[model samples]
Target: MKFNRSFAVLLVPLCLAFGLFALAQDSDDRARPAIMGSTIFDWTLLPVKVSEKGESRRVLRAPTATLDELECHVTTLNPGQEAHPPHQHPDEELIIVKEGTVESLVNGELKIVGPGSVIFQAANQMHSIRNAGDTPATYHVIKWNSPGMLSLKKAAKKMQK
Candidate 1:
């Protein structure tokens, strides 16, 4: 290979530009989260890390910037399993069932939420989702948080007696 100093100099900037372009691709995880049908704002798919093996998995997340700020997740819970832990966060949450039924506990209030069933949870309130039927439970989860007294992760640990 003939080493051309002029050619090498020209290629260096091109390679650097390509590298920067590749890095900018998918800069934010929520930029392309798979949402059901929310085109009024930014919606995309979020890759949730489900460590434990579950029967099913589903999520449609749209994050503005932070994890819970104007975020959304459409989760489907198989019968006899919980999608999320029994914890709380510093954000107000709204869960609405789009299909099937889901059993959830919000601030100690348990209910079998079905289609059109909406539940509003305040910041720092304990919550959990468990499939309470023989079929899959799917819901649209929207979380918007104002400044709360404490983080749900910390509050959950403190409430343990």
Candidate 2:
């Protein structure tokens, strides 16, 4: 095939622009939700990970089809152990008791709740959960926000600095 040198010169920049555009689109897609349909997550199958506070079986920690900061995990706090001191975050959260009892402190008020109980903590509200029973207390922590919580974390870090 016969090629024109001038045409090739113009095509090079066009191809580079197209590649850059595609890369930007890909980056945007990553920020958006990746799941599209109903999904079932089994807690028993998820691997357990230990944090400074306690042990957790993280179910999902990614953006969902409808939420930007959808996170769900099963946490077990040993008797006499609390999940860190009372703290607050910008993301709203719910703790659903599954096994044993828990002492839930919200905004300095303490309440003991048992299995099948749900404790709702609004955004930026101080709250903490501790095992009230003699055995380990297990609960599911589910949280979500309109936008991701990274901005809140970054802002908090800046304030500390």
Candidate 3:
């Protein structure tokens, strides 16, 4: 059987396009399944992971019915220890202080707050948290990515590379 040169050229590009589409679909399938209905993440049951800075309890990292991605975690920052340097991301986040005192960089200012205090970090804004007291500081962080946010993040990462 003989194949036409023009047909071969068209077939090669078509096959490549399908292969790329299949790869994209496979990547999406590998993402964590979305959360549905009521769910409970008991504090006592969650495992704490110790790190050089302190301890952390990861609650969840999955999409919800209304969000592209939802991630929650609790951090225990040891005295005089900072979680990380002030950095910014496209996703906004909320920090709820549970114990001790914490100094958070919010909107370029460092403010100190204790238990029950809430800190909001706006999208693309520089923010960070550190223990400001003699005792360890514990806080719960909740971050979410709205629809299309994940794609934007991927693009930004690609540009950096």
Candidate 4:
């Protein structure tokens, strides 16, 4: 076969352009660690266990009204139960399903979620998660409450009750 110099020249710029375009489309992956190793964080490890009303020694309750940024607790839902009775939070929550299946329920509707799955519970909107699977469901829970978020949540909670 005979080679075409003109066709080859045209392809060089096209390949270079593709490479440049791909590099320009990067994502936001910045690291920001507040309390490196403290009980204030949900995703990270804590020094020791703390107790409070509506909380158990093993399971740490939510309502992390700490500050602008707060790490909740790692709630592992075993087979046949909701992480919490259908409830909502004022601040945004990031629920990262680490293992097992998570049946997420929002306002009575059911949503089946599994490992590596996440379901956000919007502030003031009702949401909950349960493990419908046979095994336990583990997840890294992040409940961020910024200043007035807690106050707003308390008011809303009162209204619901």
State which candidate has the highest lDDT: 3
Better of 1 and 4 by TM-score: 4
Distance from true location, Cα of 25 in model 1, Å:
24
lDDT of 3 by residue, 71-158 (tens): 9999999999999999999999999999999999997899999999999999989999999999999999999999989989999999
Residue-pair clash count for candidate 4: 1
Q: Tell me the tens digit of each residue's lDDT in model 1 across 14-112.
A: 999999887788574446554334454332444454434233333433433334335566676667778778997666778888777778887688888
Candidate 1 lDDT trough over 10 residues, lowest sum: 53-62
lDDT of each: 0.67, 0.85, 0.93, 0.65
How far residue 138's Cα lies from its native spot in candidate 2, in Å, is 0.4
* Model 1 ranges off by over 4 Å: 1-68, 147-161
Which portions of model 4 show Cα errors greater than 4 Å? 1-67, 151-161
- On the 0 to 100 scale, the lDDT of residue 145 in model 3 is 96
Cα shift from native, residue 62, model 4 (Å): 12
Q: After superposition, how far is residue 149 of candidate 1 from its true place, in Å?
A: 10
Order the candidates by lDDT, highest first — what do you get?
A: 3, 2, 1, 4
Instruction: Please give, for residues 16-36, the per-residue lDDT of candidate 2 as tens digits.
Output: 999999999999888766753
TM-score, structure 4 vs. true = 0.54
Native-vs-model 2 lDDT? Answer: 0.85
Give TM-scores for every candidate, taking all chains together and pairing residue i with residue i: 0.53, 0.74, 0.82, 0.54
* Winner by TM-score: 3
Cα RMSD of predicted structure 4: 16.0
Q: What is the full ranking by TM-score, best candidate first?
A: 3, 2, 4, 1
CA lDDT, candidate 3, residue 17: 100
Between prediction 1 and prediction 4, the one with superior lDDT is 1
